[model samples]
Target: MALLLTANVAGRTNGRNVARLLQNQFPAGPRAFRVPGVDSLNHARGQPVSWLVTRTASISGQELFNNYGLKPNSELILGYGFSLPHNPDDTIVLKVGGIEGRWEIGRDAQGADGLWKVILSKFVEASDATYEDILDASGMLQEMLESLIEKLPEEDIAGNIEVRADVVEMFHHYLEGMSNLVAEKPPEARSQVKMPFFALW
Candidate 1:
């Protein structure tokens, strides 16, 4: 008989780290937690990926935003705009197709019976000034998340059990690498970028 040993490693905890960075920027509220495996990390090179989240209030809960408007089957469409690189010598205007996202309410938003929805846009910038482009991405992402948080009440997620451990573990596996974070091209590559935060409002 032959015996085989296998190793199973868990995700890392950078949730606390990134959450601290977010907290430093805003006033106190529900803590920020990050998780990886929620979305696929190995995406096609050069393509941007958007992670759909129904409710920051409840991960397992339905979406809170969806309940206000639209029926259970209704849909919300969010726009995502991106700017790609073009030479100064070129006279033609540049416009890339935006990525569309949807938001829906489920058991997590309210209760099993209640429903909610979210509609958000995702954008990307691929100009010669890539660093600035990422900053723009961060700003856009932060703006959207902040707006969503403000639309909801703190009570929705207040004191609810936080998925801090899940966040920390996921961050370690997916978001903690320089190679993964930045564009490789020079001039645009030197700039620093930050991940957007979703805090309790």
Candidate 2:
């Protein structure tokens, strides 16, 4: 498995400063490299520090615990990698991922003031087309919900309930559409087997 470690230091910081900070904070293991940031590759250019931990290390289960002091079967890696600086204006993001799992450290945009965020994400491959489609649909649904919520009056309880009902109705419609598709095709010709409605929920 190929493991990648990346660190992005934003606001009044440079790639050199980030590289030095990581080196001082996590003195162990191979050194990290300073590379140009690819977040805005087409329009704006940026320089971000990053590290390729290893290409062959096992990142699954007990291997992570034995190698990086991480909890077994969990992708979270805290108190082991580089430490975050104590500057409020500066934001530092750390990401580690491989074929087995992925993890990230940053700030929570939706949380309370000064709240830190640590995320353990599941690795999804590009070849998993169905999973990718589901993720895309989920993102679209989230955007629709956010737009609807923003237009709703905060003091209106009935409006809130209406929004909830709308979402539920949309879910029911989706299930009904799926059921129609299944009914239109023979069992052997169906792309996917029909799952129980409760299981889908």
Which numbered prediction scores highest in TM-score against the true structure?
Answer: 1
lDDT of 1 at 98: 51
Q: What is the C-alpha lDDT profile of model 1 across 1-201, one tens digit per residue?
A: 111111223765444444454566545644443343332222222332222222233444432221222212111111111111221111111122353333221211221111001111133323233545555554554454345435433323336567565444433332222111121111211124333322211
* Backbone clashes, candidate 1: 18
Error of 2 at 117 (Å): 34
Please give the clash total of every predicted structure, in order.
Answer: 18, 0
Best by lDDT: 2
lDDT of 2 by residue, 1-201 (tens): 223344555654355665566567667754554334533222111212224343344434522211222121111112322211221112222222323322221222212111111111232332453644534433433343344335433333344344554444434433333222222211221222244421321
Report per-prediction Cα RMSD to one decimal. Answer: 24.3, 21.1
Q: Judged by lDDT against the true structure, how good is candidate 1?
A: 0.28
Off by over 4 Å in 2: 1-13, 40-201
Worst 10 residues of 2 by lDDT: 112-121
